[model samples]
Target: MTGNLWTAREIAQQPDVWRTLATSLDADKPRIDAFLAPLLAKEDLRIVLTGAGTSAFAGQILAPGLSRTLRRRIDAVATTDLVSNPREYLAEDVPTLLVSFARSGDSPESLAAVELAEEVLSECHHLVLTCNPDGQLYRNTAGEHSLALLMPEGTNDRGFAMTSSVTSMMLAALTVLGANPDVTLLADVAADALPDLAKRARVLAEDGADRFVYLGSGPLTGLARESALKLLELTAGRVVSYFDSSLGFRHGPKSVLNPATVALVYLSNDPYTRRYDLDIARELRADLPEGQVITIGCRDDAEEETWSFPGLGHLPDATVAPVLLLAAQHVALATSRALGLDPDNPFPGHEVNRVVKGVTIHALDE
Candidate 1:
């Protein structure tokens, strides 16, 4: 934790937190199943995964895979969209499940979106995943229609950027949605590889690169988005960051590459998606400087410079996301320190905030 202080500790503590999350998951299974079984049985159920900021990205990361697993209409709609334009997204006839992700669970958008859903949709059930037990979203979300899941203690990150909070929520969503991945193995692999990953990120962050691009495919795309935001937040806007799907990058966004730019490709485990991810990594390597293109995770990584996840290639992209995310977190933390900023509170002037301020949540009817 010496390198980035509180941010580092939060990042380093993730694997353990993941393990604890898994251990407690079994105790929740019966209750979770009781709540979800009937809702999922409804063929017309429209599941909307949501939150604000990093919490929203957690839903984005889980939506694709969860939809595939559940074979239902699932969407990752941010609470920001729901609050600002409720009528456009909500339908009264749809039997909807609003899965909200929140760290403190108190973000104005978090509860407002849930309230909007309750008001607008004729049949809306809530599944609240939050890190804080006492936060509004968890404390009294919905007496019966809502089933609130609390993440492990200490996941309420003290850092400006979310490290464990978002990931923990993603894992909870994955398990509840029936991915039921081997959490122990994922946690074990992360614990084993995190030290070296941290070192690699520290060196890379200190390399003076002013621009970073993260590319991935499918569920990995959400990971790329989260990675981009982490760098931007930790560096306090001194460094520019962008994220797009691997194939989507070729459609004009590739212009961001330069000598001072580094591209990180989150290789997917899905065979088809991995092809595009690897292709972009190779294309960027030839286009940018020799060491500027780096691949994170998976088997094909041997062909390119990579920050490997030794035992993780066999898992689904959904399971590997949080583990692979450690690299991005460390990179942001190191980048913040290298630029002489504080990771714990990147915007000390309140130009931005850990818990965002000044938002005025208005009545949807008005």
Candidate 2:
């Protein structure tokens, strides 16, 4: 295995990066609070989280739990959607907060999404979470109506796949969205589990399973999507990976499992939702080969086969989702290496890009 890949280093640095991010964001809380206080007070404000690709999935992972906790309709509108079809989503009469997430902060759709929000929405405010300070989102958001939270340096991952960038931004969103999750404990759990996780991921990748499935409920559903995308990206599409909610998988997607398939079910912490997740996990374990089906989540007295986040059982699902991703990130990186691909730049031909290109943003019609 190559030890010097930026992807591996980026993946391994997440726990420490998260701790640094926590300290810095906490120090700036007063200003962040000042910026958010008045907007959160408004009952009519529509909160939309927008980003492209991996950044968009970050919003999907955060929206359900945040909306429930905040008692507002928070939508994870992707920048692709916001750019391609702004008229369908943006409302003129409603005050809206467009929370944009970006790793590079240079994507054409990202900038176009912000401009479209400003044009279409009557009362629009911007909250830009980006890793690059020099990116357009960070530089152009100096207006009174916007607040840009630039993550500590090194979070802008140099890898082709987003590793540190995704987790850092998710932690930032949790803190900014008014949840006081134990950031230290989150990092601690990841730190404790990573070494073993890397070993397990290596075994899994080299284990001859060419297909993978990730399933979860609610916030974990999006985490499943993020995990699937990570695997697909890091492997350069050499191995197949798919995602679905636990209940939804039974409909038609369960066929993804075969002798060469490995299925991982992400159990939710919510008691009722956990039942549905367990139902699928048990069924998959029964149907698939032993060790091919695994469960991931938080629990105090977790079963032997389950991968539990040791001390984080009580955190909200959204707050806990980011940490759960470390497992998948490792698996993806390991699989990429096992397949003899460069995790840092998987596509030698540039069929895919770290930051998407060739997307022409068209003007919105009146």
Instruction: Give the per-residue lDDT of model 1 (tens digit) for 1-366.
Output: 333477888999988999899888888889999999999898888999999988888888888888787777789989999999898888546999999999998889988998888888899899988899889778877577989888999999877799999888888889888888888888898898888987888899778899999999988999999999999999999999999999999999988777888999998887777888888888888888878888887563455437888776777887789888988998998898889988998888999988878899998767
The superposed Cα distance between candidate 1 and the true structure at residue 197, in angstroms, equals 0.8
Q: Which stretches of candidate 2 lie over 4 Å from their true place?
A: 1-4
**What do the candidate models score in CA lDDT, each in turn?**
0.87, 0.89
Q: How accurate is candidate 1 locally (lDDT)?
A: 0.87
* Candidate 2, residue 34: lDDT: 88
Find the 10 residues in a row with the least total lDDT in model 1: 297-306
Estimated TM-score for each candidate: 0.97, 0.97
RMSD to truth, every model: 1.6, 1.6
Question: Each model's number of backbone clashes?
Answer: 0, 0
Off by over 4 Å in 1: 1-4
